[model samples]
Target: MKIQEIREIIKLIDQSTLTEFSYESEGTKIKLKKYESSSIFTNGQQLDSSSVVEQPKVAEVKAALAPVVQQQKEVVTETVEVAEESKLHKIKSPMVGTFYQSSSPSEAAYVQVGSKVTGESIVCIVEAMKLFNEIEAEIDGEIVEILVKDGQLVEYGQPLFLVREN
Candidate 1:
């Protein structure tokens, strides 16, 4: 809100490896950004605006550029623009080892194709060593496909089910 506040924010941002920082209160917003010389280079020289600039104009530009910069970032990772292979919601393993579809070998599988799952449903089990740890779904969706079968070895963070949104 004041010069002292903005100074404190800048100091806090500088203490970390953060390249950008922002704050908003009562219609007032402030941002501190680290501009790398290599990125903003004109020919071979760097553009340095270290001299004292007015607070209002600086805040206005920061507020304006923040959204534009973030939009540019989102443009690259946007799901529609990404290849189809990248859009699959990868249901990954939380731990490494064997993947089991049921609690026991003879029991029915926890989930199968077209199975609907909520956030709390136990999707599968990952046996790390002797302990069989039950893995649960973190989202609500319909199971599209089972990526792995019972008794198969799976790595941590591997997709077990392809859950299509309901």
Candidate 2:
């Protein structure tokens, strides 16, 4: 299905009281669901659903349309350091929230590319429902990349950083 069509469908869903929707055509499948506790799920991944009029993010829509296996293969082939990356440990978010690299706007980021970190080190913060959460690296490693930008909404279990073990 085309992206425009998907957008239209999402708009309609957002306007209505529908709790779940599913569509499949020629191997492309799309599913959208809203939970009672004010969370949206697209193909099993939770999305922020605080506002009824807010549309699903474009990235989430694209992810729902794309074939997971193909996307994985494409990502692996695109990087030259696939071998090195395969060994990198992923620091994932523990909950759905807004990601912040620093404690505050004026502060330096907790960690950056090439930054060395220990298991107890605070790598970043996640803000959910006005509470700030300090996220730890959970492993001894050097940060290779920061996957999400500061202030981006991160889902539970989403990879926040890539670390190469010491």
Candidate 3:
């Protein structure tokens, strides 16, 4: 199945009550399962939700996932910084694609730190599904920071650059 089709299936399953799903077609098999939040049971006895006793396994799981959560928080913090800078305007990706700083490998980047741009200036390119789209700087500004590296995969609405308006 195509990536878009799989994404759609996941969205559909997540919105529905089904916890498990499987599909197979033309030698391609896919399975999806959602975590069920149910009462924990031990020794054939259901534990009370308000029980003071703590589960060792649950504690271990939380400890193991702490670092992953911290990493996600760091990413969110970067986005928040962009939003919090009152004088900086963010150039965000218009689509989910691979970000390119220049038109090609041999060319210099379209814009760099301290570069001046007008509203019609092309700052970068975002390639999605084989189409290369030239992204323009909608506001006249000086590039203060490039938030994404060249050739990086970027999500829609992710900030690509921070600029100070002229």
Candidate 4:
């Protein structure tokens, strides 16, 4: 299926009340899901449901690292190096999908290791339900690692890239 057609389908889904949608054609299967999370309030003020809130990448990454850190601390104990770790952040997949490193097969990979990226930079594409959603860096950083290979399947919240904050 063409990307354009898939985009249209995604548009339709977004405009409806459906939480999940799937399509299959010629041995290609696509699935899309909407993640509905509860509302968050600050200072007793309710934020609009339609607003897009950009969560801090570092905080999310740190939360994900908690278990790993505990394991390492237990393993090393007194000899554990308390040195400052690199301030690297991760660009995570927003949805479950097949990840494409570039817009097309013939195109060069978007952001590779050592590539500098800003919050607006497009690092890769995640195709969910045939819709090619451009995944952005969403943080100012230098790409330190590309965690997912081209065309690899990625889960929601999975780290796609490790970027050192600039």
Candidate 5:
């Protein structure tokens, strides 16, 4: 399924009162669950409904019912420095797909470290099922780091870049 279709499902679930929702179609299964925060008050009092806050977690989307191939690859660890600025932000993936740094293989990357961007700027593309979906920064900032490499497989809500607010 396309990212747009998955987004629509998420939107519908957000508008409903259901705590859990799942959909299966054409060998793909998507499930969404809402997590409500629980807090304890002073004097050992129970928390009331007014204190509850509900947050919808990212919907998990799986490709095929049957899983087959597995490949083993080398692993490496790298340390990244995070900005001390409180306005630092992350641009997260809206769907699971293969991340591309540029529109095509031979072109320069859309954004790199120190690149300034606006909320509507297209930072990268996540290609799923042969459909390339452009991902926006969504926040005005200067790109501090690129989180994903070219052709990397990313999951829903995965951070693609670290940006410091302008």
Candidate 6:
């Protein structure tokens, strides 16, 4: 690439908060970093043709990397919920999947916060491997809170709902 194009690219990276960027074409490769003013550039040497065609989405890869960094310290998370002491218990996911409130797009939710439920009541569904597992309320209660949002990826044993027993 020409000098003006590279300046434009660097300006673009600097203007935006992109932490890193790279480009390669015609046997030349260049990498840029926004952490500091200086960027590491490797030139003249030819990059393997395979590297140019299969450019990975840096945003997606770095998006998942945040958790690893947080895990290295301790579990750091913003609290979206709280628990209350009562003759009640929380309904939890048994497996990992996207949690859904309704069976289909147009269907009413099986249960909601403030909804009364029985021991056998279908409170929610966990969609794992294309199969929707109906999650039942283990204890008869009135739902005090709904934990996970619809269509959110839920981990095994994650709190799905909190209920206050009747």
Listed in order, each prediction's TM-score against the native is: 0.48, 0.53, 0.50, 0.50, 0.49, 0.49
**Model 6, span 1-166: residue lDDT tens:** 4576567566555545467877654455769885533333348655553333243354644453444445433522322122134335979899999999999979999998799999999998999999989999989889988988999999999989989988
lDDT of 4 by residue, 1-166 (tens): 5576567556555545556877654455769786655674668987766674443343443454355456555756644432222346878999999999999999998888999999999999999998999998999989988888898999999999988898
Cα-based lDDT for every prediction: 0.73, 0.84, 0.81, 0.76, 0.74, 0.74
| C-alpha RMSD of candidate 3 | 15.8
Best of the candidates, TM-score: 2
Candidate that beats the other on lDDT, 3 or 4, i.e. the better one: 3
Candidate 1 on 4-25: residue-level lDDT in tens? 6466557545544457777654
Candidate 1, residue 73: CA error in Å? 32
Task: Point to the candidate with the largest lDDT.
Answer: 2
Write out the backbone clash pairs for model 4. none
Q: Residues 1-166, candidate 3: write the lDDT tens digits.
A: 5676667567656545567767664456779896645575778988655552432343453454355456567867887885668569999999999999999999999999999999999999999999999999999989999999999999999999998998
lDDT digits (tens) for residues 36-133 of candidate 2: 66676778988776644655564654565466446555765766477778889999999999999999999999999999999999999999999999
Instruction: Report the CA-based lDDT of candidate 6 relative to the real structure.
Output: 0.74
Sorted by TM-score (best first), the order is 2, 3, 4, 5, 6, 1
In candidate 5, stretches whose alpha carbon ends up further than 4 angstroms from where it belongs are: 1-87
Error of 4 at 154 (Å): 0.4
Rank candidates, lDDT, best first.
2, 3, 4, 5, 6, 1
Candidate 6, which segments miss by more than 4 Å at Cα? 1-88
> What's model 6's lDDT at 16?
52
Q: Give the TM-score of candidate 1.
A: 0.48
Candidate 2, run of 10 with poorest lDDT: 60-69
